[model samples]
Target: MTTETTPKPQHPPLEPATEGQVLSGAEILVQSLMRAGVDVAFGYPGGAIMDTFHFLNRSPIEFILSRHEQGATHMADGYARVTGKAGVVIVTSGPGATNTITGIATANMDSVPLVVITGQVPTTMVGNDAFQEADVVGITRPISKHNYLINDVRDVARVVREAFHIATTGRPGPVVIDFPKDVQQAQTAFHWPESVDIRGYRPDRLEKKISPSHPMVQKAAKAIMRAKRPVLYVGGGAVIAGASEEVTALARRCQIPVTTTLTGLGAFPEDDPLSLQMLGMHGTEYANYAVDQCDTIIAVGARFDDRVTGKIAEFMPQCECVIHIDIDPSSISKNIQVDIPITGDAKACLAALLELVEPTERSEWAEQVLAWKKHHPLREEFGDDEIHPQRVISAIDEIAGPDKITVTDVGQHQMWACHFITHLRPRSWLSSGGLGTMGYGLPAAIGAKVAAPDRAVWCISGDGGIQMNMQEMTTAALNEIAVKVAVLNNQYLGMVRQWQQLFYGRNYSYTCLRRRSICEKVCRDPGSGKCQAYLPNIVAMAEACGWQAQRVERRAGIRDAIQWAEETPGPVLLEFSVHREDNVWPMIPAGQGVKKMMRGMELI
Candidate 1:
């Protein structure tokens, strides 16, 4: 059955307002958000932004008061990733605006659309370095797709509208509009422009559909038809362009196997036979081997980042041709050079290629990939005593199925979740890909659940990473958001420990979460008699935060814990005490080629 892709909802052209209808800048800002189809915003209130909050409280739009500015920004990012709408954020200047920098960088790196409105000090205090003032525009210019400082009250509506347009168009990313305190109080004639006409900014023109007769599309199609061992390498851009169906259709039509990056997890259903799960570091061994052996790589909407292309010169050494399709022209040939580059919307370019490409078979190559899958499958053999992290991820997939959204923090747990969880639909998997932000899981899950109330949202985080933004538990509790959080409590910074053990001769260093300043400098591994007691009980902390919490120490209780959390009405936290030394496998160590993957005890 073919699933029809829903086109992104466009804000209707603003209706002309009668001449000389005056409104405060804050009121105009609120009106502009409503016109942009934004029904909700995530932010924290502060003195500088109080004027906007006062009007927001009276408006129909819901304002979620996150526990921190960073959390608010992440929430907005999660909402945007799932809904294909520009997520909105409002925060005060100085620290409040600075606090959002990490989240802004995260969104910009992942190409998530967000419109952040920051409240600056009064225009009169611009150069005086006034209290609670910040140079937000200057600080965020490098990180954001675009940014503006509103000097005049009349520019509020126009700036707000253009912010959304820029955020959601082209290579989508964060946009900031710093509004001064005096401007928020100033009166402005609310003249909503019928259309935005930003000079030299024409993403709409670039998004035009390419016909199958286009020379580039024909070239890509011809290349694919001629290849014996072709691999379809996809990325987050495919998900953003809503080209999953096209990707799958092309893969099936050409008998090309599909391998995705970490950010491309849900772009193609992992359960499909031709799907190679994920490729790169921590990717399936078979997928990496397939890419290593493939003759041609049809890369769609994917930039070959370092994590994906470890030791770039040696990556895909056997590949003879590369056909890259992307909407952003700059991303093409930015990393690995391509033989055929088709620049346009991923969906459009893919559709055009599908029309021109002919169906074929590569039974020998498919068999080779399958043989590798059978030889080095993704599986962990844990003794009957311990709870493996992979089991927790698999159980969640089994209980929640593929329809629910899974958000993850960066670490071993993130890789485990990515490797084991079954993602059947686009937007079902959300993670901090490029920035690899540690504390992104819980807040992002909160935003995902808020944007999609009916869909179940699960947060998979590690013991080390979860604490980074665990304060958001209060936001979830206060808002009564039923986001299920599973903390893979390994009592160590598992990923770093893995690297330390393998490369640094087990000098664990600062990777142990239970280490204390007073403890002996040379601490042994857990159960080595020198280890101290686990610090700061996670379950107790969750209970203190007003969450329905539990601790699962054994493998047998994994399913029950997940079911209990799922059945709980409000926010729930499950601290699974997993084996401390377990490492994510099928990993190509940093700076190594994909062909040199180590799995299971091979690393040891």
Candidate 2:
């Protein structure tokens, strides 16, 4: 018997394609961004972008209000680094956009992908020096990977979409999109396109991007196989390329030891048995010794920066072959003569090398390296002084453990922090390596904490450097970010002072900055008992910023105070009053070779 036919329950098609309602130009821009998957933005609101900000709030997008425009940009940078996405930063015209230039330049140098939007003055006000007007597009042209000034409201949607694409593609640098205030307010039909078309922005079609299948990979693999004592030198690019695990595996497979640049700390866990820590200027004795003794040096994703190679001619003299792999072709053979140059993503290239190289035990070479390590262990000479920077750094490392992240400003204390702290994870230690910016520690720590709230973040700064960005403590307090700051109060720009003592016959020009009293006021000439450059009491400053504060006058109190601050669930500051005359040595003076290092203390 045939079953009775049942009526099917049918639903209407979701809907056939139809023309959507026309929207304001601002609405189109917002819709375009939503299509590009921008979930969050960081910026300071101002009048020029008022219209855009108003519409932006109506969308699902979230905005993190930053204390300053510069801080907003850096926060975006930190977010980008952590998420592997193009960070979005928006600001208003004139001073607002200009304040972000430093951060833009920094991202460019580091090859971070960022989408920076600035609000332009009304189209009619262009070139008329209108109120709050500045040529942001013209100013940022040299630094950004690409930029566009959108005068017409109709082009806002297209320009923003293309900006995101350009920023994230190719070498991955920052891109700027300037939207006129009038454009943000203007209404037009909103149609979010499924794809973007940009002539100069195709990254995948490029022929120069190195892949594992390149012909040079075989030559590089051959060198590694033939060499007896190979050392793996890595840098920040390795961290950015996510090649740490592969690098460690390659080192183990080839029985090679590893050392890293300052920015490369954590790329290879410093605590790893095969890791030699860092090399060059402030590098460990074992690390430097390994470089001095290795026969084959394989540099992966690291620029042979002068700071690492120290007078390139005499650097790694025993190394006969140097195999270099970098994403940027310009970095290859720029400093040291490279025997085999394989330009590519570090992770991909390293994986290919592992496939090509046959695992072999280099017993004799390992023995020799272990012998050198044993002979040249890192020394900590914490003499019977009132305060020792080394002891403080070591205590911090012990208290915070390997899971914590440390950010430092440039100075003698920076060198000490590098020498003492042991990094156990990739990108765990962030500092201004290339720029060597003095006030980086506090702001950078704030940025890192904002990016990774769960990780313990600490700012290692000199008294001089900390003071430079003391204003950032307010930023931390405002955000309720519990970043701890350890100030090495040496009462001088200690690095410059050390240089003068070693190279300039201790002329001691402007380096001597003396405190007036326990109040921490700067004294122009304490020799005469009169004070001029009074310093703000950092502990009190922290307290004013609604943070826990402590001043450790004695050396013994430093470690405990640091431990307390790290354990405290809020922003804390520990100021250790160290000797003003202490120096960071093993210094390679201007144009000096590794052999020409100035030791911390004169040999008997």
Candidate 3:
């Protein structure tokens, strides 16, 4: 027995080598990020984050110096969105972090995984109202899945690991990590954790809380199986869950016609035989009509936003039953009551539904939808205006082609882009869909380009909205991102003007923003809530930022400029001087149902 024990192999020395040195907190942070497989970051440099950015600059990761912190976060968001990885954003304290709040909230609302790292005031200055100090943790608490404020340098590695894990797992959303200025400067014997251990932060990667046999899922599955005319409505969640393949599979298997919400644009091929145009406020008439006619509505990872449902009580009146499949339980029956509710991750739920659904032909339903599409094809109301917003967008579509990521700012141009552009690929269209943020497009486009460097990115923005975050045009030039800026310069907040035209008898309060100051500077009253005196020559601004800039006043030139911009290697700006009175027609009146949809050149 003693012989069998055998001499234990000579143990190697566990002591540290005499020449070993402790790593700095900044080094530890970057090393941990490297361990997590992070290859890129987007941010603007600031005083608070000097040390961290210094270390990051010396590291292997590629850092994009954005024109604004918000743009940085959004670029990170777009990157995360396209790659199915967590987006990383590093910003300084106070206004820097605050600027990124919109991006964080956007990710949160869209359920996109993002990790925002911000530098705080020094540890010694805690609670002293120090310079550039903002309570980032408190500001982002409700918007983020969770947030952490680092107090010690040793916790940097653990916090980052936990932050990344929390961001990427489960119902993915943004997470914030605020590190004090002193923490980044401090040195420590940093040991990156092999794994993270967080209690009460479990993400359900397996089937646990919900099941296939569960009452809700069973009811939903049965309703879907029995429905004669069923329409599948999808949302951003499908894309976030990486369920695009499954969604396409399920739709094709059942031969069901598919339509999407604005956020759902890239989830399915708009050019598919079974695809209907996106539905809702700015959605196509055909899509709305299909919703009105469908006997049953199958909502997958979609919330019945007012924009989509119109008046909820009056929406889809012909539908006798509803089946809702969503990860968030609250969304199950919050608006239109659900006949069957299946609560699970969209990707998982769709996979299960695919397995349960017997492949059957919905040829009749598909034929009806096709008929609707033929009857209500999307068309430009404006006639032969080469510089018209719609025409410009159509040309951009032609030049950029599909599969390129397109972002839009909030205004008439946004709606026009949504209406005119045909999205035939998943995660190709990114916009401030829910928030409708004005300064969203330029920065978002810059971010999107950074995220998908291989894909051409276009920023479809209004003259008014593009200037909001137009400072980031420099970012595009600096990074050589080659993002094409197609400015739909209607010189007004287009959508609001449409509402005014329809609801207020064309009073046109404060929407007009044109100014030449030839006779007198016709600046809209700044405090009148109509417009402001901040309008600038965006072409000149773009040129100043090292981008090739051209203004398209002629209709024919719109397409030419678009083609040239898309083909050019570096950043280019194509401005379309559009008509102000133009409106996106086939207008569905407020408080009206889909049945009451206004179609094709109707005199209101």
lDDT per residue as tens, model 3, 1-604: 3456667866342232121247666666777777778889888778888877767876667888887888788788778877778989988999999999998998887777898999899989978899999989999999998999998888988999998888987778899999888888898876767777887865574336565666666676777788888888998877777788988998898887888988888788877888886888768877888888888888887898888998888888889988887877777789889887777788877777776778877777778888878877777755554456788788888778876788888877877777788888777888777776788788778767777888888888887788777778888887788888888877777888778767876666666664334423433342243443445878888999999999888876776787788778899998787876677756677777876676643654
Name the top TM-score candidate: 1
Q: Say which prediction, candidate 1 or candidate 3, comes out ahead on TM-score.
A: 1
TM-score for each of the candidates: 0.96, 0.88, 0.90
Write down the worst ten-residue block by lDDT for model 1: 10-19
**Residue 530 error for model 1, in Å?**
4.3
Candidate 3 regions exceeding 4 Å error are 1-21, 205-218, 384-386, 515-535
Any runs in candidate 2 off by more than 4 Å, and if so which? Answer: 1-21, 25-35, 56-62, 205-213, 515-534
lDDT of 1 at 147: 99
Model 2 TM-score, 2 decimals: 0.88
Which tens-of-lDDT digit does each residue in 148-229 have in candidate 1?
9999998998899899989998889999999998999999788887789999788777667588988888888888999989
The alpha-carbon deviation from the true structure for residue 390 of candidate 3, after best TM-score superposition, in angstroms, is 1.4
The digit string of per-residue lDDT tens for model 2 on 1-604 reads 8888897965332221223557766667666777788877888889898877766766777667776787777767766765567888889988899988888887787777789999889988989999889998899999888898987777777788788877775466799988888888886665555578877555555424455566788888888889988899998878877889999899888888999987778888777678888888877767777888789999987888878888777889899998998777788889888988876777888888787888879998788778867876667765585877878889899988878888888888888888889887876787767667677677768767777889888888898988766776777787788999988887778998887777777666667666433423333333343434536788998899888999988976887898789778889999988876777755666666767766665830
Model 1 residue 283 lDDT?
A: 87
